[model samples]
Target: MPKKTDRHRPEPTSHTEPDLAKAKAVSIACGRRRFLIGLGALASAPLWPALRSAEAKAPAAAHWPGYADAMVIDALGGPGEYAAEPYAALSDKALADVRASGLSAVNVTVSGVGSYAKNPDETIRNIAYWNAQIAAHPDRLMLVRTAEQLALAKASGRLGLIYGFQDATPIGEDLDQVERFDQFGVRVFQLTYNRRNLVGDGCLEPGNAGLSRFGYALVEKLNEQRLLIDLAHGGERTTREAIARSNGPVAISHTGCAALAALPRNKTDTELRELAAKGGVAGIYLMPFLRIKGQPTADDLIAHIEHAINVCGEDHVGIGSDGTLSPIDFNDEFRRKHAADVADRRARGISAPGEEPDVYTFLPDLNSADRLDTLAGLLARRGHSDARIAKILGGNFARLFATAWSPA
Candidate 1:
């Protein structure tokens, strides 16, 4: 775990501190300085003040609406199904889990996983598939195109699904599709997955080429449409530049602190600070990237969250659990499927730097419909103020939604 940084003038994590991480980020930024345009706002801006008044840390609150009314927004997630069948209609337990999860909205993958820059037909197919799913289970789920619908779904007890993609491949050369996809109910987009594409290099790419002209153009168009941009799975330079150049608040939808555990998929203090200063949010994911050894635990998750809050402030931090709300069975059949998926990613040269054969993709103890409840309880026990917990859970993201989906 990382040693807590002083509230003011925070530094990148030790693994990627001034000696290494900062040097790497600086080197990439300098290498691509000529291409880094439209970043005058970030360069001219000063640090933002703390969002709320309170001690650096506060005691737990027994009150504050508990988990039921927390507006628990999952920044990134998957179809919350744990059954053996794939894409079967939601089981009784599945629906119960989602209904019980109390999630206001979850950014679900409508683009499917992996890079699709070469062919966007698959992306279109994905949108069609998800449309069918929504149509099939109108009672259990609903499409969330705007922020208002997110609130409505929560109030109605249906799992609100915010269509999103893990890669920019879906956009391809058709920049006009940004609004087209938004009209199709897609609201979140990422520049890259785990490899270079028309948009940019992913976190795994050795060259760290950052965003390209097409990537810049795509981002600008997305801003016009007011879509929420995400920088997860992007290279350091890509993440930093995207956050700096984006005209509106973006999200590092799912990542851990590189300082806590040195991994290319994790982020540095510079990226986190810049995103927060601009009123953006960063989500600490649940995966092997959070620590150097053993399976990821609740403590590791908390450490990353606290470190993010410390660097980015309370208002600019939130949860983006990169897994499904349901627990993964690691049963024999699923293990085979998991191995095939990892091998496929590695074969395609898009596997992230931190992935390994024996590692699990999610935290076991915190893997449940009550995951948010368990996490909120843990934060409460850690002395996080109720207001801070509320923001981290969903309030902050709700505000971001309203901003990005403005004029809706």
Candidate 2:
């Protein structure tokens, strides 16, 4: 339903160069450091009894799931082009790191902004690549489009691989493409990115017009197919309209609450409440700008989650760290790249209304993918119940998956 455009698509297999040695080495070093830090902390603390009691009462599995993180990105290698790294290339070593992180699943984005396939064949290729990855790593990873698949993968002691699209551009203006992708196990589809498309206005757009007719139709088609609609980068009005139009539950797959930080990209309390009322989930993102600007500590992230829980209740909230796979110094390089892209589009008259010149300037303290466990610990310290912690960590997304996935 959303209109499509010709953005530069990243080449398949561009980013998949294998780095098993590097990944494994990093994993080992990090583990050692964590062990030392834990020992030091235990030894230094005079109030050992209180700390021990808290540790004993803390939920062992609440912070990190048994499996590796269910979501992954390529930027971890370094921010060049996403396609420069294929997921398959690192399946073995990546799974090792993921397993070490105590995560059980990962949602992988096959097609993203500027990397759409023109025809069905290319689409099939994308899907096939992911399918092959699942097949190759059956011992460590399993393809999962539904909650049942996730459970099966967990039971089998493997990480679940979920296919997702970062933008709807890959569908290329054809509603039928949605069906094709649905068949390919794409359980999630974002409505828009940073710019306006045929579907609806993006969050960066100044003149937010809500959902267009095509967007509404797309929502209907997605609902009929039981595909989860994600409104992460959509405008405020667009988000509300999509929520109102969707027949089934929708999701803000990875975002934060505006009330906590007032960033344009974050959702408002009212919108979050509406989403929860519809049995939808609002995944709280852990990006820096989404929290308090310069000094966004883990507490800031937890506060946003808390605020969202207060607004939408626990079952409707989850975590979606929009972290890139790379470990760039949380500084100007990343911000400059994002700003240039948005600026170029605007200069070409393809920009949204509220688009900022320096869109990525606000960098958070916890900038890397590995900080997720620390975030979970902060949440526990903030008094999150074990059940609620599980929901926020990944259970909410699991429920959404169950609601959206359709088996063949």
Candidate 3:
């Protein structure tokens, strides 16, 4: 398992040098106790075992001194976690947990499901909401606009909130809005959600229409602005064309390997490899698309990672999770609410095909306050070298961000 070191554990000076295993360890048993006394609910995080609960929890390795220390970046988080409406701001408890979660930076969608109709108002208001949140909790969270800022977030022990969009609907016919949004600190933008837009068809659209003429123009505008282009829920034609047409690297921020479980949302081997060859990265999510049947397990998550690495090369794959940091409560009440929500999504033509009655939103074993730490431990156990694990955790994403955010 990935072990914890003291918060004082020094970070590695070079990416290609020694791995995290070489970090110094602190052995004061009471130190753990004193720390937990201050943590309150975070001490009893969902999967904290009974036997280990007695021992004072060590400052998590995933917190900053281990693999998570090397510029950890989640390509994107799942939906329903980043809504701007109801004026969601990081609560004190949520802030505390995020501080302890060990992430350097993560992409949070501020736009509603990628529609032009929702673009200016919904997205602008969402940005305003995050503005308020950042202003309120300046110590715990900050907006990340560049790769240097991503590294700074890691060293500063704060979570870098990256604004992203799941769809390109916000720009509408006016491509100028792309540059305007970039000026607004929106860094990552996906081409589509689950349906067609003016740019092109989504993965679920039966027509499979490729990138439009305007779509090509938009890609150039996005490239010109140095904003990262993402092709997550885009159709096969759109995915291929966008990757081929972009002047620089483009990302598939959250996806699965169709070679493992043939879901519409998952990418074929060609898409994975091509994106990697072009210097882009693909992040495998911890969702139902990883399995063909039943709930996904950690084993399933590992398999997808391995497959993505095999196809996309180790440098081009990372964990997007596509899940919230919040633990999913699978009680009857939640299940009922989620079911109704899923049904409503389908009725509205937003639900993807793989989402079913029992297909869980997150993996059971990975459901916890320290899911990122747990993921690093799981990857370590599977024989991934710390260097490779570092890339999988966030190195690749950071490299892409550096390139995309390069000054024009």
Candidate 4:
């Protein structure tokens, strides 16, 4: 996620909600005007839609016997278009895709990352945009604050959207912002993105400096408030230290096993073991980081999942496909845009080693609305029991979320 410069921002439309009255008027009404303008521009690139081939077909959904009764959750994903256009109403296709996804809940990111995320006001506006979405589509969506709400969403057949941050820049130097954002219904907070921040070094930081004094305080505050602490992109020392220090279990929301593919973005076995030992969960992502040199296939994804299960046990492993629900339509225009997007990330210094122009972020063979179900069948064929598949799907993460959000 590169910084959102003015030139790259989209023009403000009527749905941009320039007026604070339209937004859930909060303590930060002072920056309401700037927030709306920034959000209008920020909405253009919610989460980068990495290119995928139009010719690539999704696997036909197989019959997973217990899939219907299972409560599925994408620990680190979006409603797809909810990230793309939160300010505007969701498109018919976007709505249809999410409803068809069979997703019980998704921990959708609602804050900026990288240098552009320095402003707390921008995060506030992102939260407002999501709130507006839930209000607009009450029948289809709900903001998940507690574990009970997650179950309710599944029981009601609605997609519960949980607010989370991929980076902690929005917290800034003020420790109070932790609880402040928590009151706004933010449930999960990641210490860093892919580089250094106030808390500590990210996975890309060569120094590998562990948590700072402020970072330690942030952990305590997060624990006291009962918010889920995510160590997905933290450096080695940071991840290990946070896992040791937190009062409750934390989550490495989306990543691959570094033993299979030694990428900085993927977690090491030591980290995974430590995370699981502390009652934490590790979510394997469907990103290019799963393989070192080529586009990751379904087997490559399964290998990482199997490795994680061996290292952390079935209860600790789950799916966290960083990609959106809708598969990318890699037409000529999309390819052009994809190239430019990669170039921009390279220029901004946020691009990782595996992020090549040709390597898409999702698994091609398994790309579809019913991807989780398809994965279940693949595991079932591997002799994974129905109970094991259920835990890997969402049961484990659901339990972890409930514990993290529970009172101290």
Q: Give me the runs in candidate 3 sitting further than 4 Å from their true place.
A: 1-65, 78-85
lDDT of 4 by residue, 1-408 (tens): 211111221223243223445233322332322222233222222222322211222122354668888999898887654135346667677778888888899888887888744558888888998798789889989999999999999999999999999989998889899889999999999988888988988998899999998899999999999999999989999999999999999999999888877788988889999999999998899887877765665666777788888789889999888877776654566556667778998897778778877766666556677778877766665557788889999999999999999877
Please state the error at residue 244 of candidate 4 in Å. 0.5
- Candidate order by TM-score, highest to lowest? 4, 3, 1, 2
For model 4 the local lDDT of residue 193 reads 89
Poorest stretch of ten by lDDT in candidate 4: 1-10
Separate clash counts for every candidate: 1, 32, 1, 0
Best by TM-score: 4
Task: Please report, in order, the local distance difference test score of every candidate based on alpha carbons.
Answer: 0.73, 0.60, 0.74, 0.78
Candidate 2 lDDT by residue in tens digits, 46-142: 4334433444443322233322433321111111122234443543445555455444565666655633455345556777876776676667667
Query: Each candidate's TM vs. the true structure?
Result: 0.82, 0.70, 0.83, 0.84
CA lDDT, candidate 1, residue 284: 82
Off by over 4 Å in 2: 1-88, 91-93, 114-126, 324-370, 406-408
Off by over 4 Å in 1: 1-65, 82-86, 112-119
* Model 1 lDDT tens row, 293-355: 545656677778888888898899888888877777646666577667678878977777667
Q: How big is the RMSD of model 4?
A: 15.2
